[model samples]
Target: MKSRGLLSVLTFSEKRENLLFLLLNEPKTIAEIKGYLNVSTPEIFPRIKEMETKNLIYKENKYYALTPIGKVVAKFFQPLVNTLHVIEENEEFWKEHNIEAIPQCFLERIDELGNCRFIENRLEEMYEPHTEFFENISKSELVMGVAPVFNPAYPAFFLQLALHKVHVSLILTKNVFEKVKNEYRDDLQRFLECNNTSLYVLDDISLAFVVTDIFLSLSLFYKNGIFDAQRDLISFDESALKWGEELFNYYKEHSKEIKSL
Candidate 1:
């Protein structure tokens, strides 16, 4: 038999999707669905009938819940819905930034960036270190990151952070690593000498992101592959911090430790 057409199965209505998601947890009575959805029977019944006809749900006594097929379908649809919500939450950030710079595997799990916020330096402060960024990372006991580009302030600030006894780990792209070694050898030396710091070098990387115990900040390349220095997607949410740490670890695992530089 031919598979249900994509539009036909999933595109019935937004209410259907919401109902499917709601039922994934537990069966609910019509009154419960109506109360949770905040809609009257006239607004919700037709969608429920349609879902029932599609075998997406079943009614027993007074409660409605997903069928086995519906649960599987919801398992797949939830991610697509969640990923879209995340990207759209910071629509322009994801739109203008070169999201392709994010690796394919992590990009697929982009929804893991729960409740991220777009943060930008003011025009007058465009080239300066972000105050909020400094504030958040400064207070963390452990900080880790990947940097694909150079920053004049970072060498000093990160060294200071390490000196303050914060454990610091970083993965830098080759060019960025060399740039720091050539331009800020003293700071690089200080960082290396500090017991709290470790550095690694990757031949190439496509994006910049930092994760600390407190927060995560990510900056992406522009669509043409040029780095964007002015804006970052920042988040203090625990899930986002976990996601960012995984991203940092991905590059670190693929990189070589830089004991000298």
Candidate 2:
């Protein structure tokens, strides 16, 4: 294939397409071509002359035939026509389902094409979606949040955090403290101790949040289960880290003296 360098030179119209198809069966004079298409000679002659001028066709005797470039152009455009035909064939079927979004795109493929898989979650599921409202926590130097103590998946995320060596201070509620004491406290405490991670016993605090120097990821729990409050994690870019630091500082100042659990 010759590279035309990102531009198309082909121009098309209904008349040209019809003439091209007719010529494909075998070349014929203008009179014969016009008669075959059920059109008068005057209507077909101008189109043939224009196609010849565009190098889409060439005249030999009184017959017109596709130029080499025109054949290549036709082949190149066939895929697009086939795709349109598919859409046309399914148009009624899609209309019946009331589906507004087309399924032709490859969003997940685009995301996974690079070295890492890019994951995205909905804003409604996050603790805060407003970029401006979370500005303070988005810039923190450190974060201390209360943990739910009962969530199974919470441990998985906590393990990931420990693996990453991200700094996050956790405060476990007394209700959580008692449960852990009765069951998983020893293992949980050992894990925390290994990381030199800080933990506070459940006191006045409400929920759990993991905070790093620049961002916060929060989770809360009620009788049902855990909900994300400070839902999305933010990065500690220079400016964002500065803002998050202020928020962390404010919380640190206001929080009651935290003792080791």
Candidate 3:
């Protein structure tokens, strides 16, 4: 019952939540709250009073500040709010994919993907590689990836990038590596020969993602274990790029480096 009441007060209104957020950073007087919230005294005072009654905040001199309990609540609310934003931003995409394929740590930090662009294939382009994705990655100087699926276009394009001195570090599923070793042996050999290239083979993985110097793109298997070639979640933000690097390393450490063949 106590927890229920606190949760209700914490989530009661956007204004209340905003007030808590404002106090999380610094103490503010009524005038400052009014200026930031753009609400009149009649509107702001009642919300402040409710928070005070809950002991979520306290007044010191002319300023309002979060109590220690309020600070702890503020800490709790941020990740919850950020997780909601990430799920809300791409509602359908998140709903249909196997989100569990993403490791827990990365999923918790989904907020890093705050600036993501969720691109679904057009009906006419349903089977084609995303032109914008290719164009954006074309300008990259370094690319790190984990792939569980293979496309016919990848071999030639990745080799072209490597030939032009772009650093390429990739981890491929055992099956995909076998397919490449047998079918595209020349291109695979040439790609591995580059001083700037590194390759690895790892199985028992279910997601494909790439992080480049310019952007990050993620692809995941359907809940039924099939890859969806139609949609891509891409982000150009530096934070997402950092997150992707960590994700790549997580799998890379579990993989076998292919110095050749």
Candidate 1: regions farther than 4 A off: 1-9, 236-239
* lDDT by residue for model 2 (158-191), tens: 5445545545565566676567656765556654
Candidate 1, residue 18: CA error in Å? 1.6
The order of the candidates by lDDT, greatest first, is 3, 1, 2
Model 1 vs. true fold: TM: 0.85
Ranking by TM-score: 3, 1, 2
Let me know the TM-score candidate 3 reaches against the reference structure: 0.85
**Against the true structure, what is each candidate's TM-score?**
0.85, 0.33, 0.85
Cα error of candidate 1 at position 135, Å: 3.3
Residues 1-261 of candidate 1: C-alpha lDDT, one tens digit per residue: 224653365656788788889999999999999998988999999988878887889999988999998898899888888888898888998888788778899888888887788788988887777889988888899999898888898999899899999999999999999899999999999899988899999999888888999999999898987888889888888888888988888888899997775
Best by lDDT: 3
